[model samples]
Target: MHHSGERGERPAIREKSRGIWRTVTWRELAEEAAALAAAASARGLQRGAHVALLGDNRPRLYAAMCAAQWLGAIVVPLYQDATADEIASSIESAKVTHVFAENQEQVDKLLEILPRCPTVRCIVYDKDRGMRHYKQPELVSYASLLQQGRQLAAEKRDFLQAEAARGTGQDSAFVFFTSGTTGPAKGVVLTHASLIDRARVAAATESLKDTDVAMAYLPPGWIGQNLFSYVQPMVVGYCVCCPESSETMLADMREMGPTYFLATPRVLEALLTQVTMRMEDTGGFNQRLYRAGMAAAHRIDAGKTVSLSDRITAAACSLLIYGPLRDVLGMSNVRVAFTAGDAAAPALVTFFRALGINLKQLYGSTETGFFVAMQRDGQVKPDTVGPVADGVELKFTEQREILVRSPGMFKEYHRDPETTAQARNADGWFHTGDAGYLGDDGHLRIIDRIKYVGALNDGTAHSPKLLENKLKFIPYIKEAVAFGDGRDMVCALIDIDMAAVGRWADKRSISYTGHADLASQDEVYELIAEGIAKVNADLAQEPALAKSQIHRFVILHGELSPDDGVLTRTGKLRRGVIAERYRALVDAMYGGAKEVRIDVEAGHADIKVRDAEIIGHRQIRSAA
Candidate 1:
């Protein structure tokens, strides 16, 4: 609201609607929030009431959240891609009374679960498509909500401001739900002061300017996205652009050319795969040029360049290849590229650095308001997420589990005192559940989830996430599930990135129908086996992890989605569920079978039956 008076015309948020970009000024955003706050007050929403925001990244949703906080209400954003059942648990857990859904699909999910969730009395929808036939009493369009809000604002001129005055710094602002990778999602309650303080720290760390632009495409439910896109932008007075849809993310990123970028390890991997596939498809001079350029860049990155000839080669490569590639990836203007959501593979992070992009890593979680440790510019390390942020202290337990004390720490887990107590102690140290140690350089190096870190049958240490990150860094592989716990040897179920492998196949004129067909091909098996072999070769150097090398593997015939109970809505693997669901394949790999009869339903789509090659010591073929 202060920004509105300071710079009313400044663009606060931008969104692409129906192929055209639209901007909302700071002044307009403040009015919408204030009016919505007034209208929500009329709807019986008060301080401490929980309001739910559901859908993709949109300006209206951001306005609604601000409106919610204007009235001292708590905002809970549910992942747009989450199933109705998954959303129901979140709505029920928060006892959400009012929900602002982005579109009909989100509103429909709310209505479907409304009968069971009696507290949800009002549903405000942003877009009215496919909503004309609905005659639900709880349903109201965003247009209507705004009209009502304007009327209420006119009637009670100081209503919203008065309510805002009652809000305290200690009051809860958001309740971000955990990803539920291992169990049910827990509502992590964070306060206004906490998020605001951390946002400022992050902004100061980056020296963020009002001229800087960021794109918001990730789920609002994820704290990492919320922090970078919503909270930090608000604090730093930067413009956050929301893409039209997930399908248009890359195109939008190219068009907008944001100066700041944040993405998951998965997103980065996919982008790299896309670039690699594109390069491979052109397989002539361009392919040779890219390879030669990358080799020079790698040498430059390792400080192995000693001759003027080497420097000249690298500079030429930068002009011919790296510069154009960065422009194509829409990262040429990116000042600070951040990756979180799972510590990315060191190799993956270094790839962009080699291309002259300042890609860095951040180590934090939902419970920490998303800022604990972040790499500073010019001091980034591929293996470490930099030293702790200002006002944050980090320590490690005897077991190497990381603990943190940050000003941005969560207040508690909403209605889950026991879990909250377990997470934080009397000393105010928050147990991060992540296991890692500090490097001599004073940077934090995270390995994997403390509980998920385990050993093979021979007691050789194995970290599934580390291995999975390494696999995902491979262009052909997408998601991997490593199984070796109490087993004779490590075996993996590989999910081939359809787009990447499909492109490779298409480039070779290899005919295939769908994902299952492509995955079942012997050539695809050879590509995946090649990736695994490279990973094993790397692991062989580390004696402790040598035995943890994957000796056998099988390709998954279908995607592991949330509906299948094998993956959480946020893409975290339910390892137990996956292991049991793919028991036949897992057994076959260990049973010395040459192939596994993969029979898994493709998430309410169809029953897929395919034979997946169990590539082992004898079956593994060298990539041609």
Candidate 2:
């Protein structure tokens, strides 16, 4: 495609920063990218050199990405929220020769690890926040680099053309690091063809249009963001909007009124919580209306096709109840809203649909270039991941592990042939490591990771993911990990939703110092006990899970965090890690100890309690 400014009249990117929407036209984007490419070449950077782009979402960052592609250079996007050590490790692993820092803080981090990353000869900064004191000879401002590129482009048009000409579909385009749930992050290399093919599939599957407005809120280093923000927009000619900051995402969403939205289940969960919390404070009239509308939603949620009478009632409800509610939540114009990265609660999915949002689930990974399966508009089923995308083949192994073969699959793990061989078989099927079965309708239902699925001593196989998902469906429980493999009974380590629990405590006038005090409080334990009992009652209805019901449980003193390696970036629980870390608590639960003294890591202090209650479920008698 020739570099045409014909699309310049249309907005390509609208970056909302500091409550201001800055629109960049397609022509302006092309010119800026060309200028950056010219400048990089002038800096003596080779065509195939690895360039690291580390920053929050910004127009300049996007420009750099396109520029790198135009020059046949590989762009490595790093998570801006990662710690300095994590950034250093990625920089060293990728052998990045040039670094692009978003602000002074990032520059400082790069400087801290500069001695380790000897390959990084140059650092280009964007925000210039705190670099005034450091007099690094290699440091250069992004603006100055763009100016130099513009100057070079003005003189050497032929050279720039030759550089841009070097780019091809076969060349390596980007490298995204996996979330590293098992070990150190692995670099999944994607060529132009790999990414572009998947983007085309996604565009066709979702029926993406030039008029669609996408909100690019997730970390750009992730494969999901790559598909939504970087690749799909280019393929479908859609406009991608970046919010100002993490805290400003909600406000930016309201202002942009995005037509296309994609977020992890955690984001949706939080939104649902916020909605419920706000509704709890509303008046009787509005609450009654909301209840009636939600009841109507529940009817549709139960797999019942809406009747004409129900549709009319629902339409009336949408106008008076759901429409204003959606507008307030900034989801009024949402044409496609996808929730992935983790499985969401069925009730949560139904809630959105009741409000007229076309929310659906999708399945993919970095190795697959992020497009594997997606639910179509009306064919969505809450219990299963939809069928495989066009041109993709999926099958289940004897072990029930889902395997995939697709055009968008990555070539190999960068510099790790042994690991690559282990992931991809000789027969061309890439082992997904996920345990799932294809339903009668051909939709895939993932239970858990195959590695995590285990059998009890009695030989009953259990899927922890399914049980955990059931537990999380309860509003009070934020996180839960069930452990019972090779044991007689399942037990759980539960993390209560602090906000919800605090509200409950406040209503009862139960005062506590913090999370630790609240968690250990007797009244709080009673509340959580009720929640766990409810979960057990629900689990008892399932044949496979009934035997795996939680026999003993304890509330965690604090929330699990990524910093502590208890939760992955995608918010999936690291069960093994948590099990090891809370060994004392686990022992106490099974060892018949009434109370246990635990050390709080935050304050480096030990907390002692006497005769703490361990909740157990009462077996329900058979109906006569």
Candidate 3:
């Protein structure tokens, strides 16, 4: 395969850092990567050696990844937000002998755990923040390392070429850790061929173009980032832009004007909230105009040809309303956007489509190198995850679990035969653990995880994810977790969108103390009851999940936190863990109790009361 810089002076990466947009051409990237690889080799990093990379979105981090691949060394990326203990565990498990940290804070964490991780020999740090006092003899600055590599390459040019020749399609390119659904993270070994095949398939299926630009804001440690940043770029020759920081993503996005965007449902939800909040701030005249334009856009979104008069109105609105909106959101140039980590609200999908963005859903996992299925342009559907990508064969097991066989599938979980065997059957189909079915139109509709799925005492199957997604579609509800599995009726734990709830409270002059107190207020419950009733009405229209109605619900006193073991680092809920932690609340829901008191483990002892009031409502459908 050709390297990134082989295409002359074309820009390969645009990184905004320290108030400057630094543009690096393919040739420059290739040179820097080569230098870094030589420098690493000089530091005794052999081919097959494991190197841990810890950083946020940065150009040097990307260069280090490419350099590791050039030398046939496996790159193990750790979450930048990881604590010292988590980093140490991953390092020890991967047997990482070398590390590249973005800043001194990470280097300090590595130093703190050095005594336990004997395998780590050398440390190279990028940002020079607060590292002068660090007295480690083995530590070196990234600039110094790159300089050493450049000098070494000048001295032994032929040797560097021979070292670069060591890499091949068969070599293990990356070792991605899973989301750690069970215990600690398990490494999934992916070779160059596996990643490239997946990228090729995704590019062909999506019809990705070389001119397409994708924002690389997701964590590189995740498989999604690797696919979008490393693999897809190699296959489609697209430019990947690194935002200055997480805080400046919206601003950077506006500047980059990316054609292809990928984000989680949480991110999309936040954007929708921002849009709604801004609309609330607008004057009545602007609000009416916005609403009218959106109504027209919705008609266009529904595959209906616009009338000539409506087209003229929409064109005028595009200039007056939508153009500025898209510019402000930095999505004016977006040709295709995707959301996939968790289930997204169909309204959120339709909202973007109504704004003239071709936003769609994708379904995949780390085991498949993040390439499974994508909703093609002009065929986007809100209810389904679209069709399988080219070269991927999907089937349903007897239990209705999705099974996939593709070239992108990982070889095996590192050092764990038992776990690997549990995922893949003897017939070579990888069990996705997801319950889904193929529709009459050949689209795949994922209900929920097979393990999380439960049956009612009356023998009806219940899908909590389906119910939760439906509830989250309500504007006031931020998150909802439905619990029924093995129970007679379904109950829900709801988290309110504070901004939206605050707006409602302000209009009604409902005073509250804080989030916890506001959530427990009787008025808040009434507000949420109305939202829940709307979700129930929507669910009642569906056939399968309609039976599992949300019989009861209570607003959670506080948002779920990682420390509480309720949410993962990526913000995915650990359903079993959350249910176990909130057993008292769940019990109260089914016990027909009006209220329950639970001890919250904050810094000090805090007693909180959670109350649930049932709102009797029946099926009330609204025009779609």
Candidate 4:
């Protein structure tokens, strides 16, 4: 907020307000945050108390976050899409006594869960269009809260300033929950210094200017959002734009022309699927032109010389197709685009770089403030995460687990010192729990999660995540989970991309009503089999992974979703939970059953049972 004084009259944030774009300057942002801070103070939000922030991305939401920090309170950002029960768990865990709801939707959710959380004392709301009749004593309108703050300011002019001055860099700025693949999520406590330093280094590396624009779409509860939309905006004084809603993200992004962008592998996969589907829907001439342009682009190696003919073709294609394609994807102005949170497909990386997007893979975790290894300019490697980031040190364990130590390393897990001690050794090196190796050029190639890396019964090592990533690159497969740990052969559970595969089916005159019906179709199974076979062919090329080829596979009747507890909020598979939930299916594959009947819990309340045929396509080859 202090940056507002140094950089006056510049737009600090922008978002759609009532169907029109509304911008807030840095000066206005500070004023708004200060008022909110005073109001929160008036509500008995004392120092070190946790303020739960529940809402979609909004200018007022960001202001409240800053306000809470300014008043020396820790901000806890809850996922707006989480179930009421899940939100209650986070609120209870954090012992949050105050909540800042975005609108009536979130307020209703809070009200539903309020009976279970007795500690909550104040409920401050932003949008009150439909909430004029709410008479709960805890309920406070945003305008009224600001009015109270103004009255407090009149009585004590230095109250907010004094609170801000009392804050130290080591104080807990916020606590972000882990994705919780293995178990219940743990809160990772990050301090002001750690987060600020990480953002500073990143901004310096990218040479971000105050004039740069970035989209704020990722869930703010995640460290990535904090770094890109929150910390970097404050550090570099750039404008962070929020979309009206999740559905309008692409449209809003196209209009904003963000200069800096970061998206998870899943998001990139979706965008690629959209692009491919759109191209297939175009006329014959346009489809042929896209294919030709892509072929030309592929010929121009990212870091190598191109022949005169190939160069000319690529330039022509750029002018005719690739350039406009980028504009349509809202990446025409992206100075640096990254895909992280897990390994991105090498194919996706090559595809984007081939189109001149400067797309790179980044490697980090929530505990590291989300900056560890980043691809640098002219050092892009599709198979590696480039090099260790500035101000970070990395080493591998005997078991090949990556260990990181950096100035920006997190302080500890909130209220969980035992787990914190286990995460970091006495030397302050934090175990990343990811198995990887360093290339000759100092780039880091992540294999998979350390615990998930295993060998077959005969001792041929394989990485399930590595294989899964390869399968996901097929575009027909949306999610893949490989199982071979201590087993004789590898098998997989595949989730078809409903949109992409459905389109393929429609083009072939196939009929289907829903995901379940379409996935069960024999033709769809054959298509998935083809994709798995391609992955097997690629696995055969690797000497160490050949024996770990998928010997059997089954297409799931439904997608693995967070609602069913099969996936975490960040889209990570809860492997342990999945294995337990599908124990019967796993046994059938190993028991030599050719088919299995499985029951899938549709959501929190519905169960859907379906029969699936297990197909064994064992192309097990020996080490070359």
TM-score of each model, in listed order: 0.95, 0.94, 0.93, 0.94
Q: 1-624, model 4: which lDDT tens digit per residue? A: 567888879999999765689999999898888888887887888889999988888888899899899989998998877888888988888889889989999898899999999889999999998998999998999889987877776565588778888999999999898888767898998999999989998889889999999998887777887788889898999999998887778778889999999998988878888877777788686777777767666656555566787777677767777787788888889988888887888888877876778788888998997889999988887889989889999998899999999988888988889999999989999998899999999999998888888888999986888888888887888998889999998888888899899889989999998988888788887787777777777777667777777777777778889888998887889999989887776777777776666655554312222222323234433322
* lDDT-better candidate, 2 vs 4: 4
| Total backbone clashes of candidate 4, pairs 3 or more residues apart or in separate chains | 0
List model 1 lDDT by residue over 25-83, tens digit each: 99999999988888888888888999999999999999999999998999999899888
lDDT of each: 0.85, 0.81, 0.81, 0.84
How does candidate 2 score on lDDT? Answer: 0.81
Query: In model 2, which runs have C-alpha deviations exceeding 4 angstroms?
Result: 1-4, 305-313, 602-624
Question: Could you tell me which residue pairs clash in candidate 1?
Answer: none
Model 3: what TM-score?
Answer: 0.93
* lDDT per residue as tens, model 3, 1-624: 264535647667889988688987777888888899888888888888899999887778888888887788899988787788888888888899889999988898999999999999999999898888887977999999999988887875777678777668878888888766545678988899989998888787777987889998887788888788778987888888998998899999999999988988888877777777777778697777778777777777777888876676667777887788788889999988889877776778888777777899999888887778888887888888898887889999788899999888888887788989998988779998888999998888888888887888887788888778778766678878888888888889998888788887888899987888788778888777877766766666666656677888878888876656677666677887888988888888888887777877554222223333333334242243
- Candidates 1 and 2 compared by lDDT, better number: 1
RMSD of each: 3.2, 2.7, 2.7, 3.4
* Model 4, residue pairs in steric clash: none
By TM-score, who's the top model here?
1
Kindly list the per-residue Cα lDDT of model 2 for residues 1-624, writing each as its tens digit: 232444666878899766789998888888888898888878766777889988887889989888877778888999887778888888888899888889988898899899999999889999876777868988999999999998887776787788777778888888888888766789998889989999998788888898899998888788898788878878877888998888888878888999999988878777777777777878587777787777777677556887776666666778887887788778999999998887676777887887888898988888987778888877888887788888889988899999999989998888889999999999879998888888989887887788888988888787777777777766677888888887877777888889988987898899999988888788877776776777777666666667777777778888888778888766777777888899988887777666677765565433222222223334544421
